[model samples]
Target: MLRRFPTPLLVALCALTLTLVGTAPVSAAPTSAAPSNQARQLNQTILYYDSSRAAEYSSAVSSAVDVWNASVGNVRLEPAASGQHAEIRIITDDGWPRAHLGPVRPGGQVTVWMGRQGTAEGYDAVRIAAHELGHSLGLPDTKSGPCSSLMSGSTGGVNCTNAAPNASERSRVEANYGRGPAGESAADGRLLVDRR
Candidate 1:
């Protein structure tokens, strides 16, 4: 038989769990020398955008991609050409912006929702796009981060229009996708629950 935790205890536990889930590193270093050129080529992860519903926010998507592309070199996100199979799909919806924890590897599917809710509240569209994409890239929300931290999500407040990933954020993504021993797994995706 088990007893339930008190309300306060439960809340605290939930907070801690959320923190750990969002902040813990999800990468493992390779056990041996790096793989051959062919293997390195195979490690590239490409994310395709649905682009239909997100048409209105194309600039935001492009800006977000530019931020990530400029920040890291291992992963490349491209617009899904017609009839192309997209590993990750992004669309616009009515709720708060969010993304599926993810497919993490190729041939898997993940969805990113670009909700108007955040924009309506004054959050920068590019930042929201990048923040949600960060989830797909295996980053969790650092709700306490200031405007400069891209993963800070909504906690940076509406004025945080900065869409660039900070140094640490950039390093983490590079570590996850950088060319190295062939077997390092990309971290799992984590949803950012709006605590505000």
Candidate 2:
């Protein structure tokens, strides 16, 4: 037996198939040329420190790096190679912990003094690390926020061991470095906040 679709019906079905196929969503196809949001994070903003005298705070510094690394998509802090020029230098002092606000470039330098004064006051070492590093990354001390905010610095009080930056703090870092390494060109030496 032989059967045939009517000419009009067959034409309509063909037209519908073509229309659907033509209007298919672009996301359905994988494109080799597309770049992903994560791919943009490949540009690592390396910062190194000696931390020789601040050996006691080594874990704190590492924890701070981990906190920032987890919070932002761009810019990573890495320990510098031995003898390599370091953009950020960390040392210890008798006073409160502090850092130079910087996008410090190579051949230039910034100092993060991990002072004992803050820890003596009962501030968390890890929070102190993150807060000082926050200054190094271009964030000013908020000082007014709660312990939940890392940038609040000493205002968070002695029990404030929260080393994580608040949402706005995280967003600012991402916005600053998310686009790429381009925004880091600002000249160094802004302000210093001693976690007092």
Candidate 3:
């Protein structure tokens, strides 16, 4: 024969059991930590460019986009979809290449002028495209910097042709985009002309 506990005792035991279980520690699953690490990459800011008006410089623009995409993790550059308005516009002109400096936000507008003069003067087309795009990414001209620095522009000379951004330039672009869209400011809209 089994003995039955009093109703009051049974209730007390039930409450105690629930309290103990409720207070038990939970160890996080390994996967739970993965999202934090992946979040930044998953949230990478994307800026689109319209090269339709760039004319003969389209391939050069594409190559410059490739260089930037390979160098940074916080933002990505992609061709604008048909009928979609792009944040960056590439156009060809007879003058020197220039870009409206911007850490351009999504839906914002900035122009990159791919001037024929630069190519005519023997500067690498890819280098001119990359340098102008760098201005769109918020990089200023480091006119005195060596050829290894993509922002050095025409000062790197016609033979320079180094279309890749150096470590510091990459880091600055990464930091600019990492701040997300809300961090955008009017001051980022300066026009950078790549003369000389």
Candidate 4:
């Protein structure tokens, strides 16, 4: 439901979305300090790469996912598709939109365009991925940064990343959505992982 992309975003041809459909938690937060309406959402990590760069793209995804697993709640990257209903999936979309990045249903799927890997080398590192995921965690952007600061709008070559949501980031989302809901969920998405 929350959708806002900066001007001049990526121009991808094919992008996938992962949404979470769940009921409200049994122990809702006290009305005084919570977003009046709660939603069931999932977090998705997407990495678009060129077909030639596919081999090493996974290493990046794993590196990023590891960080999320250790700090964020317990959400895992759904396996690559095997013809079933996958919450997280990867597709060979000629060109997915690049501006597509944000929160998801914690265990939902995101299509990382494998077609745009090389362009990511000089820029877009684990930090960028983490920061984006932070958004999924319900954090917002600062529109500025120290370059290494993940919240900064400056893209690429800025390896600077700090996924530990800042006070403002944490307070803003939790203000609406409750504390991390059970991270246990399902996504129907094919992770472009381990493909040679």
For residues 36-88, write the lDDT of model 3, one tens digit per residue.
87997777889999999999999999999999999998889999999998999
Span of ten consecutive residues with least summed lDDT in model 1? 179-188
Taking all chains together, each candidate's TM-score versus the true structure is: 0.71, 0.76, 0.80, 0.42
How would you encode candidate 1's per-residue C-alpha lDDT over 3-50 as one tens digit per residue? 988999999999999999888765644534466655755766666766
lDDT against the true structure, each candidate: 0.76, 0.77, 0.88, 0.39
Better of 1 and 4 by TM-score: 1
Runs with alpha carbons beyond 4 Å of true place in candidate 2: 1-34, 180-185
lDDT of model number 4: 0.39
Q: Deviation in angstroms for 30 in model 4?
A: 28
How far off is residue 99 in model 3, in Å?
0.7
- The regions of model 4 sitting more than 4 angstroms off are 1-55, 74-81, 84-102, 106-110, 114-121, 135-140, 153-196
At residue 107, candidate 1 shows an lDDT of 62
Cα lDDT tens digits for candidate 2, 125-157: 999998888887778788677999888888887
lDDT over C-alpha atoms for residue 97 of model 2: 89
Best by TM-score: 3
lDDT of 4 by residue, 60-167 (tens): 444655665554332334343444443323223223212223334533434344333322443444554445444444344565555544455333233544434455
Q: Which of the two, 2 or 4, has more TM-score?
A: 2
lDDT of 1 at 101: 61
How far out, in Å, is residue 144 in model 1?
A: 1.1
